[model samples]
Target chain A: MTDNEQRMARAGDYVLGLMSEEERDRAEHDMERDAAFRDAVLTAAQHFHKLDLTTAPEPVPDQLWQKVSERIASLPQMQAAETAPASPSKPRVAANARPKRFGLHSLGGRGGFAIAASLAAACAIGYFGALATVTNPQPVVVVVLDTPANTPGAIFEAFADDSVRIVPLEEFTVPAGQTMQVWTLYDKAVGPVSLGTIGAKATEVRLQGPHLPLPKPEQLYEITLEPSPGSPTGKPTGPILVKGFARQPARS
Target chain B: MDATSDDDLCTALLVRVARGDRASLGELFAREAGRLIAVARRILRRSDLAEEAVQDAFVAVWQRASTYDGARGSARAWLTTIVRNRALNMLRDGARLDYVDDDMLEHFGERSADAEAAYAALPDREALKQCLGQLDASRRRSILLAYVVGFTHGEIAADLKAPVGTVKAWIRRGMIALQECLS
Candidate 1:
């Protein structure tokens, strides 16, 4: 087949879930960087979904919608009224604007977002050895935050003192004039409370809040861009960049 | 409502969802969740994983509704695309579809009489049925197996008792033919 036909066919394979990891990664990267490739993938997706006709409907679990609504509540606020394709640009936060704090209203019912434990997700924890207490070693929990496409974004570690250490593993940068604020949601009923402002240039930082309780299992950590200094509203008002669930470390 | 009206309702609900309307989301969920779950379950094979995929897709819809342009496609198709991708990703990340038992693969690919009847009943799916019918049995089976079962080229080859290269060629050519025929 010719190159165009080959590319279209490859797009078909991608939508069909037939590509290997390496091939998939290359195609995904193209989808990210190449608009034409993105269109090809979209077309392939549009066509491939028609095959759903072959399968019969299975009974849906009762609580599935509840679970989904909760997850949506936990996500970062919608970027804008118009949905924009994810571009190479970093998330931007408006300056001098009162950042909107996450509220529980948008979430349906009382069942807020569930950060179910994904302990099996391979995550590397880098603890500052000097800070490790020899007499009372505290369990350090690490969560590798990923993009919707499953690409690793950052490593978030919560300590015994409720303090969180944010480390950049892959490309994550807050544009100049904007600050990246971290937040956590402890309860499904409660909204995400701000942790603190992180430096744009800083690769790693330990965030400590005296009033906040220690980190617990199933707590979600997310990063959102906001105006300088921090969100005036004490909540995230910008797009969520990366997020992950903190699961209890596997017992030794 | 007719299918076109149903599509319009979905689009309107998506607009409300984009505006942070929770009730509209609930309405949309009530309407489409079952169908979306069925689609995901078929690809992921595990009910729990399928639910997870469908859940993620709805959450995505809530967040990404503003991105939907009516000029491009129907809202139902957009929703299905999200759930389908989510389900396929789960399978890939978990390596759930990497290995398939030969006996199970045989059963999975077999088209039941009931399934044929069901396919014929859906008028909206007639074009797809006709397009799929035009391919030879192997190519059709390869396309259906890959789409419905989330099978990789190697897996399909193993099930078809063919070489991997030959299977890949068949899938690629088959897809091209389908695209051309559909267009």
Candidate 2:
């Protein structure tokens, strides 16, 4: 077989979890640019896919299955266990339920665009001069915050107290009926408590954290646009307008 | 333990599950446990390890049910992929697939040496077996090496001591035959 054919066959194996970690990575990369190669891989994958997954994954012994059922049935959130594929039937979330981004889950293909526009509006309002300074006797130092990659967005300054003020990197216009809810999460939590909500063209966000013991690692700060009364669920139910994670500066 | 694929029962169980109903989750499990655990065994190659893997996988599904995306693949594919990945990792982390403990070893059956034991032994395994049986041994072996052991085509070719071309043909022919058989 040609290198191309061999590569295509390898991609099928990778999808099947047959390849080792390294080979799997390589196959994934090669399959990306190779359409014909991908088709061949999918062709083989469909064949293997037909193998009654029901028959291959041996049944859990009666006792063990019972134990698992008991444990799963005991959890407060048994959604995962219930969705676990058991019979030959399809799943509920299999091609019908859609995931929403923000604004009580504002739908459509442009969901991502709305989030960007909100951030842009926030940024546009900031650089055009929208910062409110409170006369606190504590020392004020400028702190740099970055998103996934450091984009020109916003900066934050904290008072001696755990409260910090967010200064936008650009001027942004937030429409009425929408508010920016802020949150700080240290670890992967199911629900993150809200910090506070900011209004339109509001450059500075004043937040008090009785819960923020310290500016811990992975302590994320995100701003989501919620409804007027804020998220009734106590979490940011809107699209994230702006977000940044604290990163330590590198010393020379 | 479950044999009936009653649609209403399945739908009712899912709705309660969405509402965080644990009892419903148990009922659903009782109905599906025999089939799913059987799947775990074939993929894991050891009943004991398969039992634990299935147990862990199910509990995880229960906790993260809301995260399921309908646009992805079928629920069966999703669940099977999870357990299959789990079992593969369980073996990949070690050098071999043998992880049977005393409890599992004690329950040994006649033909436990085969990796595809669950799928092969099942009456439901008919379609795939007929499909695969149509292919020559060399082609079937290549497909099995890839699916059963999760070996890459290169690995299959290397292990079988054949050129990559022959391995690819065997896999292609085998899959085409399968698609027809299952269809």
Find the candidate with the highest TM-score and give its number: 1
Q: Each model's TM-score?
A: 0.53, 0.43
In candidate 1, residue A181 scores what lDDT?
A: 83
* Candidate 1 lDDT, A9-80, residue by residue in tens: 987787777776567656654554455656666666665555564455567677777887677666555435
RMSD of 1: 19.0
Q: State candidate 1's TM-score.
A: 0.53
For each candidate, what is the lDDT? 0.62, 0.51
DockQ, structure candidate 2: 0.14
Residue A137 in candidate 2, Cα distance off native in Å: 59
Q: Please write out the lDDT profile of model 1 over residues B137-162, one tens digit for every residue.
A: 78877776677766767767877789
Query: Measured by TM-score, how close is model 2 to the native structure?
Result: 0.43
